[model samples]
Target: MRMGFTGMTLDRADHLRRDEQALKLARMHPSARFLLLDGLKPVLAPDADRLLWVRRSQAPDNPSIFLGLDEEGIPHFALAGAAADVGGIATDARAAGTRLSAPEAGIVALARSLLDWHDRHGFCAACGAPTRPVKGGYGRQCDRCTAQHFPRVDPVVIMLAEKDGLALVGRQPGFPAGFFSALAGFVEPGESLEEAVARELWEEAGVRARSVRYVASQPWPFPSSLMIGALATADSHALSPDFEELEEARWVSREECAAALRGDGDWSAPPPLAIAHWLLRAWVEGQVPPS
Candidate 1:
């Protein structure tokens, strides 16, 4: 199954990111395009199905991040400040997925992640000194100690623990009413992906995972994370839900999950934009453990 934010079609020219002369020439290229953002929202073309790209001359005079080149060697950039009120409609990233093609959604993910990283990492973690953007916004350099830093993508383990053809699902306290999805947690330091999945299942739902298998992955750029999807065989069916981490935890059959995804049930599945939805769909269709 296709996941959101995974089909970027750009040729990320790493060779030009540090070459000032080459980057300058790229910026001046006649085919260069600029993607304008209203704050963090992406501005869509009038048709509202694609990103509204503007010539550099028509773009806002704000700091920009090089997003790489398309097939024709046209350089693409993204910027976030003082976008002109005219031209296109600005849509939240979460909602953009339904309206954009997979490749366009991928571009939004990369652009937003890079721009947000630059905004949040303007200082060196080691020296407490100001850091400047380097490598076309792919990294930063410390002003004081000359240390190099790169963007960080945190890993998150989202999984389903199956026993007797039923999958365990849970909803956090903050989740909307009647909404449940796959159990997930951040991958703690020094832990393997399989280890994290097992730990999260045990910690959140008091379920023991016997064996773990990779399912698929999706790029989740809310801030930035790699959602590692997996399926685990459960040792037993009993559950001891940890109320602190989950509002409720229970087992759902594949039919029940399919109904929720189809909007024919009392509960609503996670939206299509989320990896959780795809994971549930995969389980419902017996695509768990993948092919």
Candidate 2:
């Protein structure tokens, strides 16, 4: 299945990013289009899943972030600053995902991630100096120290632990009642993916992971994260919910998990937009162990 935010069709033309003249010419292209966003929410068509785009003349005067060239070589740009009254419905990331197509979602994810990063990192981290966008919004250069900064994506491990046909699911305090999803944690420095998975499983639910196998990945742009989906074999079925991490944790059978995936049971798995849903579904379909 095509995961959400995975199939971006843009050329990303890394070569043009560094060429000031090329980028300027692309922006001046007759077919150049600009995507509008109100803060982090993307403006969409009022009645469809389509992203609402406008010509450069209609976009804000603020500097625009060059997204990339589309299949037809048409330059596409996203507003670097929040748009005030660009007529259209602006929706949050989750709603936008359901409304937009995969390619559109991928575009939105990239735009949002880059825009957010720029907003937070307006100054040099090494020295107290103002930074300016360079390389067509791909990097920032400190004005005083000449320090260079680029967009960073934090790695996260989201995994499902399985044992004896039962998978371990957990719920955070903020989760809706009866909603349980795969356990996840950010991949820390110097930790391997497998080690992160095992450590998170053990720390959150007291479930030790015997072995971990790669499943799939998703670009979660809720402030930019690459979720590495994995499947692990649990050494034991014991439940130990760490209030600090999870409000509750338990093991559920394949049947129960399927029901949750179908939204037919008392509890529901993560929404289809989440990688956790795919990870759990993969396990329920018996595709993880790989015979």
Best by lDDT: 1
lDDT of 2 by residue, 23-108 (tens): 99988877999998788888887767899888877777877789998878899999744444667787887888866788899999
> Each prediction's Cα lDDT score?
0.88, 0.87
In terms of TM-score, the best-performing candidate is 2
Cα error, candidate 2, residue 82 (Å): 5.8
TM per model?
A: 0.96, 0.96
lDDT of 1 at 283: 92
TM-score of 2: 0.96
lDDT string for model 1 (1-291, tens) is 358888889988898897867877777788899887786888898865899888878887777788898998899989885445547888898888767898889999998888899889888999899998778878999979989999999999999999888999999999999999999999999999999999999999999996799888999889899999999999999999999999999899999999999999778789888889999998999877632
lDDT for predicted candidate 1 compared with the true structure: 0.88
Stretches > 4 Å off in candidate 1: none
Model 2 weakest 10-residue run by lDDT: 79-88
